[model samples]
Target: MHIEVSGLYKKFGDFQAVTDVNFEIEKGQLIGLLGPSGGGKTSILRMLAGLESVDKGDIVFHGKRVNDLPPQERGIGFVFQNYALFKHMTVEGNIAFGLEVKKWSKAKIKDRVAELVELTGLSGFEKRYPHQLSGGQRQRVAFARALAPEPQLLLLDEPFAAIDAKIRHELRSWLRDMIDRLGITSIFVTHDQDEAIEVADQIMIINKGRLEQKGTPWEIYKNPQSPFVAEFIGESTIVEDASSLRGFGNASDWPGTKALIRPEYVEVGKPSDFKLLSATESGRVRHVHFRGSEWLVEVEVGSTRLVTYRSLEKEIVHPGDEVQVLIHRAYLFNNNDSWIMENKLKEDPMPVHI
Candidate 1:
């Protein structure tokens, strides 16, 4: 009851979106595959689900290689982001469609359809068409249809993006619980960081077709292996002075493996004499965006812009007021720009240009 993918590669002409990706999922584990739009998250999922062919790779399930198996023969469930329901069919018809295609007995199909509708909370809406249901209901129908087939692995491709915000949250929770109860191994692909963090048991982040970092949500967020993964996963603003930090190494090409830190984690009001260029700059507030409980304050320290999230209770700075910014920390990168940790948390956050 496990799934393994090794050395997956996909290229459209010269674009190698997924390169040498390898990972395995145990039975009943929910894996969150996260990355930017072009990072090849979908490509990897498609390859596993037999939707997209791979240039080279091995996909195995339960100790048997299944890379060449077609979607139906592989016994995998696939739910697309777009719902993809037949507009002419009722909710009951949609769920029963897959079972019917498999040539299951009519009585068995009826029983399974009833059970799925109940599990997905689509009981009352079974008579309704896709157009008549809310976005969440439609998504539930999609889930029921996929589950009715009883797949070895479920592949979800951003299933909740089209739903409204409130419903998206509820559906994510519901879907996670439902999948867990079923004890089914699943791979969820999403471009939204928050959604990935909220739903996935284990997150695998990829950048430009390469595995950047894979771990628990808290682990990857606190310790990113690449600047692209860090910035892609949260509200990140790169401060230029990170180049000279002790372990940051000599700056040659790419931004020294980014000193990745979230805006909320930054500490303000440190003394200006910290000896870092960012600490010494007297910058004026440029713009401020209210983010409910916190304010996303944008400050210009000379030519570079640093974004910080401050508690709302503090007096908001005006556009012209000069403010001191202290960059207490950063990290080092190899010549190729892969992120590496340098300073410890207790260490200074103020930037020290080596």
Candidate 2:
């Protein structure tokens, strides 16, 4: 609990895995380490769990330096992506393994195992072997085993990666509620943006072995500090020479050269029903895709392709049909900084500054 990582660095031979990554986690908070593969998410997590030696810097748990602490001594409960269950052991035996290793009395281990079984919703399945259980059930067993020792911090490396899409979606809420009820400070590593946003109390975006940004999911999405985050967080289309877009400011007035448009910020409709008609741009429909709940329409405005959702309530438009596209807002970003650019027609009509 109350974990702080400072000047953290890790390398493997010639490759730098994590570079000067720093962040803090308050007690009882759930943090998501989100990034692309090989972006140092797992490396930083391994270091926090004391499984990897820190090439530089300090890891403090509750103000005590844990840099030299061994993995067993760090009081961390780890759940791997594969579940890592014992094929030969039953659910009860697997859950009790850590307690058994700690040399707890037989009666105490039995009671503890029973409690964990019920808590993880595996009460009646305790007698089943790993292969006998479903993927989700096996993962519950893994979580139960890790939590048996009552560790101070819980670390999950892509806990739901092995589960199928439907179960993974269901388990996201289940795991989140369970962790909240247990009040254990937890960190989970995930490359899936939707999973991180849906589950974590806060998210740390890692990129190319660096800590790119850290904030609540809404903050990271609505206000990206860098170009990578803007492109990485959502379904965004990058527009070059954004100043050419109607109602957007001149290129020379803003520091950023490019604008990022999110699907939600775009509206596509017939010229008759659209709002802010003056700010609307003429675009030709390029493609349309069904997305279960709604249609994903691709509209081409000049050289840039803009994507937006077509509500089921609206009349369907075929490819090659001309339509009016209204962009409510866009994120303008360059190498060093980013800015939120509201459509001038939707704003106070002042000259655009950024």
Candidate 3:
């Protein structure tokens, strides 16, 4: 492990911020720490960065215990959400500030700043001030400054939170290219699931200062271990079925299992006869949001709710239109509890998005 955190615990006064959190991060890999606000993602990052002390636990980076190491001595780069740049400094000066403090000679600092500016696509903006640059440009400047000193690992805390959606998407793409090119080991924290899924090599989900799950984007989206994780990372519907979706248990229309279906896997169709429940179908469209080629439609089925993204090509489903949905691929969980993988139905007709 490049960075290993074990039994990490932190508390403030009466509030317990983090408890028994443990995970190992490999080198040259990009990982995402994802959760909503106040979920302790930032707290964990701060602890790793030595900005906050760990109440209990050990932090090992490249086989060295860094508990007592000062933040600067840890050799970890930090990129914050606000693109913290020296407002008075020019782009090149901002990028060179860290190296200058490290006492690098003028020629070496010049070369380092020039290389970073080129690598970050800021070659022509060397003389421009932070306020003179666009949000994306400012972000690039912040990144260049953070990375100039060649830190062992990079930590990003909600780095794209302040940018607009379009800009955020663009910057995420830009970041993917730069990090891959540099082969840097980094961990970024964000509250957006889409950001984590699209950008991270592996994702760590946090809730209430605890680790909920950690895995590839596909694995986490397809096979969530907990209910909170199942509902959070992607658009999914959980159906209470009378018969288990998997054949592990008796196949009868009795109180059985919870069926989970991703919106992309759901189609407007009648429930097949082989389905768990008898013709007990009830739903009405509540609202629809058009998403270019497809539409995200929310429906209320009895007391439960489901969201489906239907393409306009097949039957043209819409708002206020009643639908008989076919859950092409669904996860089946026992009604009694979430454990016991029983009565699973594979051989789905629809394609599972990767």
Among the numbered candidates, top TM-score falls to: 2
Candidate 3: residue 109 lDDT (0-100): 97
lDDT of 1 at 26: 83
Worst 10 residues of 3 by lDDT: 242-251
The digit string of per-residue lDDT tens for model 1 on 224-335 reads: 7666666777786665546543323343346534455466544443344344443343567788888888888887766666778877777676676777665544533444
Weakest lDDT window of 10 consecutive positions for candidate 1: 244-253
What overall lDDT goes with each candidate model? 0.78, 0.91, 0.81
Error of 2 at 108 (Å): 1.0
Pairs with backbone N, CA or C atoms under 3 Å apart (clashes), candidate 3? 246-343, 246-344, 247-343, 247-344, 248-343, 269-324
Residue 99, candidate 1: C-alpha displacement in angstroms:
2.0
Ranking by TM-score: 2, 3, 1
The 10-residue segment of model 2 with minimum total lDDT is 344-353
Candidate 3, number of clashes: 6
Per-residue lDDT for 296 in model 1? 84
> Which of candidates 1 and 3 is the stronger one according to TM-score?
3
Model 2 TM-score is 0.96
Off by over 4 Å in 2: 254-256, 348-354
Give the lDDT of residue 330 in candidate 1: 52
